[model samples]
Target: MNNLTNVIKERLTKIGKDFNEKEYGFLNTDERLRTPVLITLGGSHAYGTNIETSDMDIRGISMNSADNILLGKDFEQVANEPTDTTIYSFDKMTSLLTNCNPNTIEILGVKPEHILYKSDIGEELIKNKDMFLSLRAVKSFGGYANAQLYRLQQKSLVALTPEQLNAHIVKTLNGMRDMLEMKHDMKGIQVHLKDGEIVVDINVNDYPAESIAGVLNVFNKTLNDYHKNSVRNEKAMNHGKISKHAMHLLRLYMMCEDILLKGEINTYREKEHDLLMDIRNGKYLGEDGRPNKEFFDIVKEYEVKVEYAKKHTYLPMEPDIEKINNFRKRMNLRMVEQITKRR
Candidate 1:
C-alpha cells in the first residue's frame, strides 16, 4: 500500500466503517452515505480517483420536502439541485446520504462509484444493488450510455496522442477478452501488442495472432488520424457520440494514463482532480481524493499491493457470444425508445 491508501483505511475504521479495495475503488454511490446524510466527501476523490493536493470535496443528499434543518438555512440553497426528477439535498454535506429523492437517484446514476460515511438507509442500499438497477428505472433517466459516448468523442477529437491511441486499442481488446472469459471458455485467440511485442496473454487451440492484430491495427490507425484531425478542425459543441465500445476504451485509456502518472490517490480530493490541467485537457480522472494518513501507513506496514495504474492486455481465442447478444438487445431497445419518444 502507498501513503494515501493506508490513511483512508485508518480514517474509515476510525469512523466505524470499513471498505475493501474494490469497494474503495468505486466509492460515490448512495450505498456509502449515512442516513440523514451529511457530506464529508463528494466528487471524484471520494469516487476513488485522486491525485496530489486535492481539496477535500464533500456534499449532502436530502429530501426536498425536508429543508435540511440539521445543516441550517444557509446550506438549504446548495441542496436544491435535483439530480433528476426528484430533488437532492446537498447544501450542508457532512458524511451521509440520508436523502431519498428523484434528483439523488439521478446523481447516483452519473456517479457510478461512491462511498457513504454514515447512514442506515445508505448501508441498506449497498446490500441491494438490484433495486437501483431496474431496466425501467435507468431507461427513464435519459440515455446515459449515449451521453457518455458523445462526451468521449468530443474529448478524444480535441486531445488524443500517440500513447492514447495505443492505450485505447489495447483496452478495447482486453474488454472483449474479459467479457468472453466470463461467459465462455477461452478458445483459439492469440494476441500481441505493438511496439513492446509482449504477449500479455495467450489462449488458443486454433486461430492466429496475426489476423486479430491486423484488424486491431487497422482500426487503431483509422481512429487515431480521425481524432487528430477532429481535434484541430472541430469545435467542441459540434461533436457527437462515437461508437460506444470505442468511446469507453478511449476514456479508460485516458484514465489509466492519469493513474500511472499520479502514483498516489486518496478518497477526499475529488474537486482538485477535476480542476487539474490534465483533466481539463481531456485526460481521465484518476486519484482525485484526499489522503487518510493513518490508514495509508498501515497498508504500507502490511506490504499490500494497490494496483491502481498498471496497463494490461489480453488475447482471446474467439469473439464473445454474450456481448454480441447484449449489444443487440441494448441497441434495439435504445432505437425504439428514441423513436417512440420523438413521436
Candidate 2:
C-alpha cells in the first residue's frame, strides 16, 4: 500500500466511530463497520487531475449481511462527511454495474496507488471487471457528457434566452437518440434538426412506441417550459463551474472513445493529463470568462473521434448478456455463502 492508502486506512480505523457520529449523526455497529471489500479515491483524484485545492473523495463497496438482503433491512449505502467517504452495499453496487454506471465502473479501474483498501473479494471483482462493460457505456457516457455540456453552456454565458435553451434541448435530445440507435441497431426512426427545432419520426411497428413517445414528451415539456419563462439571470459567468464542466465534458468523451476503441476504461487518465489539467485551470476560457472558439473546436474534434471509434470498435452491438448473468450469479452465491458463515 502507498502512503495515501495507509493514511486513509489509519484514519478510518482510528477515528471511525467519532467521525461517523460527527458527520452522519449515526453510529455504525462493529459488524457494519468492518472491512470493506473495496475502497478507492474518486472524482478528479481518480482521474489524476487533482489540483492542490481538490478535496479527497473516497468511494467503496462492502458486502451486505444475510439479514440486510434476505430480511429486507434498510442498508444500502454509508456516508461520512468532512472526509467525504461513501460506501455502497454490494447489492446496490451490482445493480449499478448492470446499468454500466460510469462512476461505479471507474471504481473497478482506479490505479493501484489510488486504491485505499481492498480484500480478496475486491481483487476478484477487479480481475473480472471486463464482464461489467457493455454497449450501455455508449448511452451512459454520452448522457453524462451531454449533461456537462449543458451545464457548461448554461453557466458560461451571462444570459440565456428561452430560444437558446430550446435549441440546446433539441440538440441534446437528438444526440441522445443518435447514440441509442448507433449502439442498439434501432431502425425506422429518424431525428432531424431543422431551424433550431427537433423533428422526430418513428415507425411504431419497428420501435417501441412508448420509448419514442417518451422522447417526444420530454421535448414538448422543455419547449413549454421555455415558452413560459423567456429570460434568465444576466449575472457574470461562473468561471470555476465552467472550467469544471469543461474538463469533465472532454474526460467523458475520452473515456467513451477509449472504451469503444480499446475495450477498456483507463480511470487514471495517464495519456490526457496535461490537456485535462489545462481545462480545469481555465486555459480554455477567454478574457470574457467564456469558453473560446478553440474550446468548441476541441469539442467538435472529440465528437468526431467518438463517432469514428463507435463505427470501428471491436465491441459487439450488445454485451454478452449470458456471460454477465452467469458472472453475477456466481458473485451472488459467494455473497450468500459469506453471509451464511457470519450467521
Candidate 3:
C-alpha cells in the first residue's frame, strides 16, 4: 500500500483500539424500536488529516422504529394502512429520504473514498447522487465554517505576539488549501517568497504565476488584515486556541462564498479561480512554503528570556532590596535587621 493508504489504516487501527468494545453493541439495540443509520462526519477521515489516535466522528439517524410508532397512526388514518407496509422504520425512511436531499449529496461527495463503513441505508443513499448536495453537503460546509469561527475565537485569548498571530492565520489558510486540494481541484493559491520578495501565486492548470499581481494584492491585504486586526488586535481576544484566527478557515470561507455566488457548492470553482489568476503572471515558487516569518521573529525575540526561564524556572533579574525590606517590616523584622559592630 502507498503512504496515504498506510496512514489511513494506522488511523483506523488507532480508532479501533480506542473504542470501548462494550459500546460497539449499543447501536444494535432495539430500544428505539427502529433501525438506525450511523454517518461518519469530520476528523482525519473527512479532512484527510487522520493521524494515529484519530477518533471517528459519527452521527446516528433512525426512522422506521420511532416514526412508525409516533406517526404511524396518522399514516394509517390517512391511507387506510396498506397491507404491503402500513408502517416503516423511522431510521430506515429518514435514511432513505436523506440520500435524495441536496445537502446529504454534498456530504457524501466529500471524500467518498474515505468511507470506512456503511450499512444497507448507506448503500441506498450512495446510489442516489442527486441528494448528495441538497441534503448532505450544506451541513459539511456549515460544519467547516463553524470550526473556523471556533478556532478564531480560541486564538484571541492566548499570549501570542503579532508574528505568532500571523502564523496562526497562515497555518489556518494552508489547512483550507489542503482541503481544496482534496476536492480534486487542479489549481492552488499560495503565499511564498520568490527571489527575496513575497508573492502570492494563483496557479491554474499547474502553471504558476497566472494572475500574480491580483493574487498578490489579495494575499497582501489578507495578511495585513490578519496582522492588524487578527486575534492579537487586543480588541477581539479569545481565551482559547481558537482565538487565534485560522487562515485555512478564512480560505474555506472564501471558497464557500464563491460556491454561494455560483448558486451551488462546486469544487471546480477553486480550481478555476486558482487557474484564472495563474495565467496572468509567471513567478517562481518559494521554498519555505509556509507563511511563518512572523512566527519565527516572535520566537527569536523571546529566545533569550525563554532560555533563562528554562534554566532558572523564573526571571533572571534579582528582586528589589527596598521591596524586600518593606516586606520584612510587615513581618516584624524591621528591628535588628542590620548590625554595625566594629569587630
Candidate 4:
C-alpha cells in the first residue's frame, strides 16, 4: 500500500465530530461510531486500479439505534468529504443489496487487505454474498454502461468553442469508423488513410451503387466538417475523460459478462491489469480523445460473449426470492436480539 492510502485508512477509523456533525446530527454522541458492522475501501483502490493521484473512497454499514429505527428517524447514510467516505445504515444497505446495486454488491467482494473493519454481522453478510447475485445484475450493469455511453456521446456533441468543435469532429469520425466496420459488411469497402485524411471506396460489384453513394455522402460531410474547422488545440483534448470513461465502460461489460457466465461477482481486475492500465493511461485513445479501432473491436467481442453468456448461464430466470427473504428475516432477528441484549 502507498503512504497516502495508509494515511487514509488511519483517518477513516477515527470518525470525529467534524465528520458526523453535518451528516449525522442525530448521532450527537459517538455511539454509532463505536461499533460499525463493516468498513472497507472502495472505488479504484478496491478494484485494484489505483494510481498515485487516485482519491480514497471508503464505504461501510453501521447499525442504527433501536430508537432511531422505531421512531422513524432518518439515518439512511452519512457522507464525509476530503476522504470521500460514505457509510449506509444497515437497513438501507440490505434494501439496496436486494436490488443488486453495483455499489453495494461490490462491498461484498472487496479484497481482504482492503477491509479496514468487519464485525460478526458483516462477516455473515459477506459469507452469504451469493444470495444477492441474480439476473438483476444484467439490468444494473447494463444501465450503468448505457449511462457512460450517453455521457460520452453528450460530451462529443457540445463543442461551442473552436477547439472543442475540432475535438468533437475527431471523436465523431473515430466513432464512424467503428460503426462502419462493426455494423456494415466490410468486404466491399476499403478505407485509405494518409496525412490524417480518410477516404472510403466501395465496389459496385459487392454492393448497390446507390447505397454506396449514400454512405460516401455521409462520410464526405464529416470529412468536410473536420477540414473546415482545421485548427487543433492541445488543451481541448480531454484525455482524462476519455480514459476514465473508456476504462469504466469496459469494466462494467466485463463484470456483467462474468456474472452471467459464472454467477460470480469479481470486483478485482488483477487479471485485466495490462489492458485496463493501458486504457486508463490513454494508450488506446486517438488524438481526438476517443477510443481507437482496437478498443471498439474489443467492445464488439465482449458484446458477443455477454450475449452467449446470457443464453447459457446457469442462474435462474430470477433470483430465489424466498431464500433471500428467509435470509433477511434471520439477519433482522439477529439485529433485534442484539438490541434486546443491549437493553
* Number of the top lDDT candidate: 2
CA displacement after TM-score superposition, residue 148 of candidate 2 (Å): 0.6
Instruction: Name the lDDT of candidate 2.
Output: 0.72
In the predicted model 4, the residue pairs found to clash are none
List lDDT for all candidates, in order: 0.34, 0.72, 0.37, 0.67
lDDT of 3 by residue, 1-343 (tens): 1222233344456545243333343333334412333233343234433335445543333333322344432121101121111122333333333322222233444444444344455455445433222212233343455445435433342445545554555554554444344333345677544454444565566434444444445446656655555445344432222212343343344334433333233322244343222211211111322214443343244334333333442211222434433432332221112111211
**For residues 1-343, what per-residue lDDT tens digits would candidate 1 score against the true structure?**
1333344455556644443544333223332221232223444344434435433443444322222233233223232122211113333211111111222332332232344333443343333322322222112112222234334433444344556544644544454444333324344443446674324455455555565565456445545655564655344333321222222322333332232334212222344334333433333322321112442253243222112223221212223435434433443344335435666
Model 4 Cα lDDT, one tens digit per residue, 172-200: 54445444433344445555554554445
Native-to-model Cα distance after best TM-score fit, residue 102 in candidate 3, in Å? 12
Better of 3 and 4 by lDDT: 4
Off by over 4 Å in 1: 1-35, 38-40, 53-56, 64-87, 90-116, 125-129, 137-142, 155-343
Error of 2 at 13 (Å): 13
Candidate 2, which ten residues in sequence have the lowest lDDT sum?
Answer: 17-26
Ranking by lDDT: 2, 4, 3, 1
Q: Which stretches of candidate 2 lie over 4 Å from their true place?
A: 1-7, 11-35, 71-76, 79-83, 157-165, 175-236
Q: Give per-model TM-scores.
A: 0.28, 0.77, 0.34, 0.68
Decoy 4 TM-score against native: 0.68
User: Candidate 3 versus the native: TM-score?
Assistant: 0.34
